[model samples]
Target: MTRMFRDPVFGLDADVVRRSVENVAPPGAATDIVDLFARAAWSGIAEPGDSTAGFLVSAVGASAALAMLVERWSADRIVRESMVDVDTAAFATQLDRALVRWLPRLDSRSTVRQLTLAATCRAVLVTPEHPSWPERLDDLGPHAPLALWLRGRTDALRDTAHSVALVGARAATGYGEHVAMEAGSGLADRGFVIVSGAAYGIDGMAHRAALASQSTTVAFLAGGVDRPYPSGHSNLIGRIIDTGAVVSEVPCGGAPSKWRFLQRNRLIAAVGDATIVLEAGWRSGSLNTAGHAAALGRPLGAVPGPITSAASAGCHRLIREYGAVCVTTVDEMAELAGMSPGETNEDAAARSSEETRVLDALSVRSPRSPGDIATRSGLPVGTVQSVLGLLELGDLVAEKPEGWVFVPQRP
Candidate 1:
């Protein structure tokens, strides 16, 4: 006989709930199915960075909290039942306001639909219980995500010890893009996972350069992972999915709004060990990300640009007023992340010209035969084969059944 979960709180079919979440639940985590469903529902009901909702869930567990909501428990009753240490009268008033905000979106059917949509999109629901959940996000306290909707490799989130958030202006200048490309690829080579919003200009260039360097890069989306925002970067997001990850606190099918975009910046700041603003105007949104990093006490760096350029103003402000480290090179950026750049510099110095040429000849997506690589790199096939062997051992290039391709190292 098959056991069924028929909790009236969910207002969802037991089989449907089981089927939708069973595979998507993080493997090896001792997660209760009903609790997972409750958390998923809460994710859609509460807007991003809802501290009151976080308080409620933390007070009595997600399942119990949802059950209380379903049972129409009064704010007074909720505060009393939660037994949290606080001014009961004031807490009840706050809870009442939160209830008013949460009650309108408490449709279980909609939540189930979102869950089904997540399953359809092949996305995973990563709760705090998951081993891969980025622990650094806990620093957000009540503002942290209850669960993350993730697409692509889950390992990307698990390996955040050496992550850097590269954020800046969407209207990036040529100088900004050049610096962004250098920092992105250089940091990647030094074994740091690049994190960024998938917006155009500096963010897009940062992601592309990381991919080109054959390294893991994660994008934090303001909208649902299913509906890639900025629609222009759909192809780029797809490439990230192939190797890294696309993550969001919003449930599947949620739309990105200005408020959500601002809140999203906090996650970018929280997840990374350090954050760098490559270029921005005085009022650029990247400054918002920088602000979050500063508040979290994460190492913050800003690349200095020409004083005359408007695109550089935010970086200048961060350095001059906000106490951000002035980072002009990848080595400086690495130091900002508390990594000594000496070994990386020595390794870079030791690499022969042939190795660089062979690497430059390989494509991240398309595989090429040694003879073709030799022709493209202007090296003899024998030398190309020798260099390929060395690069393969270094995990920079991989041999596919078809031929040779650039392989991004997973952090």
Candidate 2:
């Protein structure tokens, strides 16, 4: 006997619901097809981090709560039916506001399309009921995601007990990129799954280093997992999908917005065991991720940079004012994530302070002479020459007929 989910407000074919979820849903988990469909609908109906929707779904099952909405049940009636032990007046006010936000997105066809698109993209839909769902997200309380749309290994979410989120400004500097690479590869070698937004700069470098180390990584997107945002990282996101996971609270085919990106930070903070800000400017969006980590009581670390560099101002701010631990090496980061100290290559015969300063002074494009490098780096001309020789030996810098220019390293 085929079961059809029909209501006055919307109708769903049970076969379509089952087909959409069969491959993604774990065996012997969430056999109720209607409930799964309702959860998928809620993912599109509510924006990321909608507390009212979270409260409703938690108070009642997703199906019943969605039923009340579709049926146009009054706020008072819903409170009575759900038997929630809250003050009627206060709860009703919240429900009324939530209704205003939710009702417009209650179309059944849109949800069906989302499910179809997800199926076509081979994306997995993970609800709270799924065994592989990350329980750490429950700490988010009412702001937690109602469901997750994933591409790639779904087990990555379950295995996040040792995940570390490496986040920073999209406009990362050479110094920041270098640090991100070290942190990403080092942490991965120590068995920590790297987590990031998959944006350009620090985030992309971190993911690449983790991939280079042949370790698992996870990227949380602000938009649909089907449509990778920033378009530029589409190829990078595809690579992440090969071994890692790309996640989103939004369903398939949705576009990224500023508000969605801000809300997405909370998931990165919650999903990772700890959060590290590699490099950020004064108003960098990565600070938003740090704030969420603080609120959730997750360990937060910041990498300090040269005081003269404005790119690291957010990290400095976090260490000085927000009580974020100052982390300079991969071991320090691992310790911040509650791992004991381990042997690391961070202290190896790497770039010296002079080398770093000279490298920073030289641009990839406009070349600079030794005198100009010394002036810009505030090092002696003789010292700059010595450091440049060492850097040239490492193939980090090359002297053109014009002057010395930085040779960017590929991850």
Candidate 3:
């Protein structure tokens, strides 16, 4: 049955009681409050609570008499014993002056064909009330968003419950971007949904790799999903929405804000089963996401990089100080996602002898220069260089100030 209550802020009879109950209840939690009412009018900007009619006159002026009365009656009790009345029209007019303010401007147009397309693709929005909504996110406590707007197959959210957020700096080094790609592709191939911000650098690489590998990926936006903030990654955002989802709690037209970005990190951390810092600097926002992941008691991992590089500072910090595990391969990420590594069989042995020879020539100690490696490995310099480039791209071998170092990460 639709009922009405004296809205403390708006004055006209509004469904404030139901809305308040929905806001306070944990995601998916329901209450049987037959008579939920506003015994106390929420006052103050930062923290609004309850109030009595007598208190309203003094605290909110005589105009708020009805609101204050409703609040006082609505207190601790589930429903009020009796309804108090006053002039709501006058109170609403007064509140309008205090509450009316302009929202920030939004971008003229965003390249979010993905979001619109998702809706067209029959993707559904899963608010807190949805049975499929993740309860673990409640670990965020009050910081959790009121709702999680999903725009892909809802099954992905439920089935990929073991997702891990892979995030890092936008100004990523080649090493960071490569690792992100491998991890993203590897994890996705294993059926894990890759979650990221859809920003450039590590985020873009991760999403692209997953799509390239035909895997699902979700992007959590700081602003409206329609407005891919960076603008440089419109293509990636579009692809993600094509196969996965782009979600945000801010209204559809809300502009991005620094505070909103910080807040958005918490969602990425809470929604996933774990988090991996692919690449980040000393003060990168990825570190903030890691903090949220750790605070929620989720397993955190970091891909270590060259000690000399500033881009890996955040990852190193997590591993050394914040207790994040060090991971090097997608198999490890799959394990973290609660899945077994994929099997490699005899078909892998169908490789040409030249390819195997080239793989063997790359090493850490006594690392051969490309020219020398070509001669030692008894192959064309072009072939050796090509193979070495692949190795370098994989982060298996890195060139240091001293020389090339062969780093064999976990299988």
Q: Which wins on TM-score, candidate 1 or candidate 2?
A: 1
- Of 1 and 3, the candidate ahead on lDDT is 1
lDDT of each residue in 1-411, candidate 1, tens digit only: 111235443776677777777756765577688888888989988999999888778777888888878878999998887887779998899889898999899997888778888888788889988889999999998899999999998888886656899999999999999999999999998888999999999999999999999899999999999998789999999999899999998999999999999999999999886899999999999999999999998889999999899999999999999999899888778766645453343443467879867865776567999999999789999999999999889877899988998765333
Q: Give the Å shift of residue 260 in candidate 1.
A: 0.5
Put down candidate 2 lDDT per residue, 1-411, tens digits, no spaces.
122236332565656666666655544365666777788899999999999899888988788888888789988888887888788889999999989989999998898889888888888788888787888899999899999999998888776756899999999999999999999999999888899999999999999999999999999999999998779999999999999899999999999999999999999999886899999999999999999999988889999999999999999999999999899988778766644345222321255667756765776567899999999789999999999998788777799999998765433
Error at 86, model 3, angstroms: 29
List the pairs of residues colliding in candidate 2.
none
Ranking of all candidate structures by their TM-score, best first: 1, 2, 3
TM-score of each: 0.82, 0.81, 0.58
TM-score of 3: 0.58
> Each prediction's Cα lDDT score?
0.86, 0.86, 0.60
Of candidates 3 and 1, the better by TM-score:
1
Cα RMSDs, all models:
13.6, 14.7, 17.1
Per-residue lDDT over 283-371 for candidate 3, one digit per residue giving the tens place of the 0 to 100 score: 99999999989887777889899999999999999999999978888866654543334522121144345644554454434556767
RMSD of 3: 17.1
- In model 1, how large is the Cα lDDT of residue 56? 79
After superposition, candidate 3 runs with Cα above 4 Å error = 1-125, 343-411
* Count of backbone collisions in candidate 3: 10
